[model samples]
Target: MLHLLPLRTPLAGLGLCVLAGAVHAQDTLTVYGIADMYSEGIWGGGGRVSRLQSGGLSGSRLGFRGRENLGGGLNADFVLETGLNMDEGTYGQNALFGRQSYVGFGYEPAGRILLGRQYSSLYNLSSDFSIFSNLSNGPSSAVVGGFGGYEPVRGSADSSTGNGGPARINNAVKYESPVWGGFRFGVLGGFGEVTNDAGGNRVVDAYARYAQGPVDIAAGYVDDRGGSVTPLAHRRSWIVGAAYSFGSLRLRGAYLAVDDRSVANQDGSGWWLGADYRLGVSLVKIQYVVNRPRYIDNARTEGLGIGYEYSLSKRTTLYTGVSYFRNQDGAGLGRASFSIPSGITSGTDNDLTQWVGGMRFSF
Candidate 1:
């Protein structure tokens, strides 16, 4: 058995698991976090953001998690993660523990079933082929609408729950299968908690991946019927990506397509290619990505980025990188992941450039 303190103010699905249990001697708890900051500037007329900022290379966050063994190949676990804005001394995500908060059960041979707020399989699958790990300031987030709902391209919260439901689904149930020979899969569904409307604001996602040897490949899909009342918020998207490595060098690429079912003319399609080379504690990376508006003329977006990172220790590192994007033909695409409190827009036809230097600590 396991026991957890009830949340100060419950948010629907939360606190249910805590109320149903008590801590057991077999349970284990631990804390973990990361702090990252950077100094950045644009090439030409740089904005007011020539100063320091948080989350240049990674988001700062604190998390508490634990798991308990229950014999018979079964166990219980939970995670509570809160995003930190090291720059402003405030929370990053909109809500408390906004990064992730969930509870679940695991059956060794079968898989794990989790409930609460958690990432969808589409978000998880991107890690296999996204050289940038879908960072907010990276190419993947600019062109890949399916990278994650938190991307600038999809920042608005769902109307039903007023949350980042599409990025990290709320009131959702998920199942992750055990990996077998570098292969694994998962499925999830976010229930639309509207009154008497089963299809309103419903979201579904799934993915499969294979990671063996020096090669990796993955594909993901997401369908969101944002609001049953209006068809203006619905969308269907998918992505396919693969990577190959030679010695200390790794190369990767991905193709993405999005159907703006709500506004057909705003659909997007694009591809990206990236590479990384690691020399002991030092690493070098580069990538080029583009996005083309489906039915809009002169609205194509593309850019190139290069970066370097050197580790000072096992949990510390200093890094720097530069990126350039030409929003020609009204391409209007820019960094949608990590904004430095300055105004940045995507799907614009203006060229954009930026260089950033920063350090990170992980524990």
Candidate 2:
């Protein structure tokens, strides 16, 4: 049960005749959220294509986070976050609080352990190293397919129509290790919640990262074990990425791979090269990406993205971005699908190009 209190009392003259303690209280909860939207035009999927979307700047969200120190280096923390559709009042991903819902215990030196729904360790590491946080409609989203560009052990493809792990997971347990001299690690497992043996754990993932001075690096792996006809497919995946920062410029690169038994032994790899320039009122970034998925034949994609961000303040910004992705001819042997909604086939194409523009706000 939750109790709410006011901060006023009327009987102060009678030496505390009113419930002053219940009437006066301090706020401990923090409310925060973001609203992002975009206009997009996709080509080569079939013919002419266009759509309006949220998350051009970032995934739109509304959430509340609260934590209270219980004393003795122990504290309680909880989060209730949900995705939003700026184009409509309805929820974007369908699931209520489709973004995340979790509660956990935290310790200063020991680290944090959380329960319920949350992001996979692989996702945590990837997003940390990504230049755009992998926004759905942002430049990175079009180039690398954001989080969807890789295997689906951690999440689903943004462009797929099939059910996906594009965002968060249910029945998940996550542990985040404390940063020791800029080094930290994380591990997580998700329950399939299936009865009568639908499959095993469904997914398990982990990652380790180090960031000190001007350089940052990380490595991670993810596995998806399931029996669904279209399961993310049991697979082994890994990523290695590094970034170096110099004054106002930062350069980064990453490699990714996935091998699966259920999915025709598909193999793929990708790399990123980019730089960011920060100005007093805005920031500009330019990046390039190349990914190839090996199938019976072979499929490849080369992408380029440029972005600009103008901050109105710390919590709000005006943002715009554009990207071009070329699907190499004769590179259509493997499944290298990436898009919003994840796993859905937009159409057939030997190539695809995209453009997006939008803004983001937080409160």
Candidate 3:
């Protein structure tokens, strides 16, 4: 079990002593981060807009991770990560360490167990099999929208609640199995912590993946329960994906389905297909995605994206991309993720287009 202690100044000396004594030659700690920013121009919703934003390709973050060896192939590990908004020098997820905060133990032959806030198994599966790397602005982003509740409008709460997706889960306990013959699996459970309610706001996620040589395949499932009402409502989702690489070229595809029991007419399915080619220090990629609502007539959205990236150095890259979306029968899908302009109107068929250029640095 894990214990928490108040961080009072009076205990500073004792804390330092404990930390100093805990370290050994085999223990390791590291600090790492990524800084990504982009300039974008969007055309649609009766206007044209230009702006600077963060997380064009990947979210900016600072993270600290450490592992302490305990002999016999056993180890203790911890990670704390915070998301950053590079455009405005602010927090991305509304909380410090909102990206990830977890501590766990690992045994070489027995797999691992972790506790705290972390990414959902469904999100990890999408990221692993996507050729676009599952960027929020990439074409393949739509495929995972069902895993997390799909919000047609921007600036709304996207948490794992009634109608939201399961991007991340809080107060979670997770178990990950070691790879055996190129197959690996994991499970996660998040507790709502509500008094007298065991099923309130609970989350259950699981996934399995197999990778050998240049081919990879994965599948995942999630059941998210919302406790806001007397009887909880569930958002259940499932997905399957695969990727293949041959020489400098790679292809990827995925299919996802959602059954939202809390809301009417929210059931849907989405799919994406994409490919990328590498040439020396440059890479080119393209993807197309389609999303269809099960109960809404003619309510569907399709997206197409093409991007180019050039490596400036081992730690820096330059990228540019263009994306287009066609919304039919009152669908409100946009080109970019959370950064979509407010002018776009829902309940009407609209076409959205975006152009972006960005630079990313990692350390």
Candidate 4:
């Protein structure tokens, strides 16, 4: 008295489930990340020399991302990314959940708007200006004054906050517009994350960029209204850059200026130019950078760097580079970050020449 279902019908049901999964795939969550490591050495740290260290090739990190289609043209997206020290198993930047944590809506035609913790336009735009860019084997020459311990500011020094400028903003809202004909723009606001006065610790930032074919151009500015903190009372930073490529040859140039109203020499200006060429499985790049601290009486510094990278696979590569710095007027800007770690200092000086080599992998 029971009706028998066809055995093949089960297969059909399974096919339907698979099809449903695909159709609803946009509503599903996914996980993705990368792990990288490398060694580094510094010739001079303003005066002292440092030994080899891990993470010179790349900044090790792991992250997760998820997106959901909310019907119609709306979508939900979230990213929880964190950095790690591969050598010692230490976490990077901020507390446990500090790297990037936020949820936001996105539109294909319009753009993406994210809330919570994320990168600002300054970092987003200027990242390409540096040869290191989480890829080089050595430290960032931008750290010290550009000459190595001879310039006033050392590695990763906060020139803007030198005059009491605010560095990072909290409780910020960021908006990025889609590219139209190779042009796009971004704007962000930091809310101080304080419940007391709404506009007490507010900061505003914006940037515009254009990429047409092998040429890239961008400019940005950031203004921070310091809270009750010293040496961060007020700060402003501005940057501009252009890059172009022809065949296997590429060239780049950039300029940066920061104003810190707290330090004795509250104004600073910096600039750099470089080029890269590809040869079979290897890529070669060279760059020169400079910076000037305010009220330093013609205090300036410059750097010359050459880097090479060899591809091991589609997602893996090894690289090495060397740089020389010459300080003018006893300025040691070149060796600033030579011995300092990334995102660790504010307004210190360490000018020196640096050479770095490293490898990286991503998945």
Highest lDDT: which candidate?
A: 3
* lDDT at 9, model 3: 52
TM-score of each: 0.84, 0.81, 0.87, 0.78
Rank by TM-score, descending? Answer: 3, 1, 2, 4
TM-score winner: 3
Residues 1-363, model 2: lDDT tens digits: 132223244543234324223223332455678888777766555454578887766678888666767788988777788889888877755667767889989888899999877776555655555666555543342233222234432354322322234235567778999999999998877776656754553567688889999989999876666434445456666777788999888877676666656646666566667778897988998877776666524456777778888998887788777766666655232122235322222435556656667777777
The candidate, 1 or 2, that scores higher on lDDT is 1
- Where is the poorest 10-residue window by lDDT in model 3? 147-156
Per-residue alpha-carbon lDDT of candidate 4 for residues 1-363, written as tens digits (9 for 90 to 100): 111122234465466454233323445444444566655555443343444444554556666666777777789877677767676787765445445778889888899888876665555545575654423343333442322112222212222222111233356688989999999998888775446766555678888999999989999887765554442345567778888889998887777777665444367777777778899989888777766776577677666777889998877888888766555554223333344454322234434456666677776
Model 4 clashing-pair count: 45
Q: In candidate 1, how many Å is residue 5 off? A: 18
Which of the predicted structures, 3 or 4, would earn the higher TM-score when compared with the native?
3
Two-way TM-score contest, 1 vs 3, winner = 3
For candidate 1, lDDT tens digit of each residue in 250-278?
99988877666664436767778899999
Candidate 4 differs from the real structure by a C-alpha RMSD in angstroms, to one decimal, of 8.2
Off by over 4 Å in 4: 1-30, 45-50, 134-141, 144-168, 262-265, 328-334, 340-351
Question: Could you tell which candidate, 1 or 2, scores higher by TM-score?
Answer: 1
Local distance difference test, each candidate: 0.69, 0.63, 0.73, 0.60
